[model samples]
Target: MGTMFYGDDSTALHFEDRALAHLKVVIATKLRRGESFTISWVHGPGEQRGRSTVWISPSIPLRFVFDDPEPTTLNPRYLDQLATSANSSGGIQLIDEDPVP
Candidate 1:
């Protein structure tokens, strides 16, 4: 399973993998371009949703850190699927010849 986050009506962001590679890509791009946006996720019980303003910037290294967590392996195939979807939605460009990257 994966998580999907939305920003207004035009922007939709999907974050999967414990590494959060795709999410970082999108956030970095926006922040590098001086754009700010919101991302919401469902956390805790009762289906409560929490939203946060993501501040993206090129200075932020591509890394994942959580207060307390166990490492989760990421499937390359799943990352490929996410890259494809992002490409289709104009979030990112499709890498050369590859269906998704």
Candidate 2:
């Protein structure tokens, strides 16, 4: 599992390393362009019953920590889906990766 630390809060959001890598790319791109948006995700096991959303901005402190030393290969299709959601009014929604054939 990977950890994403957002803002000044000590609480950390955990994701799979592969997912975090892709999220980092899309988030970095948006933040680089000075865009602020919200990210939503469903809680996993041993967590809250529902979902959570947070506002992301260039000013906020964000960090992504992965368990693996090597980088995960990026999936264009997954990135596209994430980017599309990032641009939406509802904002980015973290979801499971599409199944590979």
Candidate 3:
């Protein structure tokens, strides 16, 4: 599994390659259509807390698959929130976000 983390001196954004790729595609498509989304993730030793968002454009294509058993549903409004958060944070990057074993 691979992970990436993006943040500054205060907070951080963490995500997995597979899930991120899927999210990237969704966000990119929305951006292409002049839309936005709110993507977020949490950061912690366990799966309890740690989340962040990123504003992505359609120009960016994600190349990974979500590793969870069940798939996540896509929501336009939710995506919008993610975009908003990403923009507010002065842009987001992969920060400690990785894949699982």
Candidate 4:
């Protein structure tokens, strides 16, 4: 599991590294274009176990940590889905995609 630290180093949102790699591309693209949007996710049955969402803008500090050193290639279809959400007024909602081997 990898953690995405936002605002401060102490608090973080965790996800699989492969999932995060895909998110990084979409998120970076949106932020690079000065677009701000919300991204939301629900915890699994274990762990914190709740839904959480955040507003993403250029000004906010964001960091992504991955367990695996290598990068995962983005699935174009999934990337398009996420990118569409990022561009939408409602914003992006991170969903589980099949993990890369």
Q: What's each prediction's clash count?
A: 0, 0, 31, 0
lDDT of 1 at 100: 32
Candidate number achieving the greatest lDDT relative to the actual structure: 2
Order the candidates by TM-score, highest first — what do you get?
2, 4, 3, 1
Candidate 3 C-alpha lDDT tens digits along 19-87:
465456545555668654445455546566656555444444433334465555544554554455455
lDDT of 4 by residue, 1-101 (tens): 88888888987988888778888999999889998889888885677768888887789899999999988777887888888878887788787675444
TM-score of candidate 3 relative to the true fold: 0.36
lDDT, candidate 4, at 21: 87
Candidate 4: which stretches are off by over 4 Å?
Answer: 98-101
Per-residue lDDT of 1-101 in model 2, one digit per residue for the tens? 99999986596889889999999999999999999999999988999799999999899899988999999889899999999999999899998899655
Error of 2 at 19 (Å): 1.0
Best by TM-score: 2
State each model's CA lDDT, in order: 0.43, 0.92, 0.47, 0.84
After superposition, which runs of candidate 3 have C-alpha atoms over 4 Å from their true positions? 1-12, 44-49, 53-101
The residue-level lDDT of candidate 3 at 31 comes to 64
Candidates in descending lDDT order: 2, 4, 3, 1
- Measured with C-alpha atoms, the lDDT of residue 55 in candidate 2 is 93
lDDT tens digits, residues 1-101, model 1? 23333334334333444435445455555666765444334343443476333433345333443333655554566556444544353333322222334
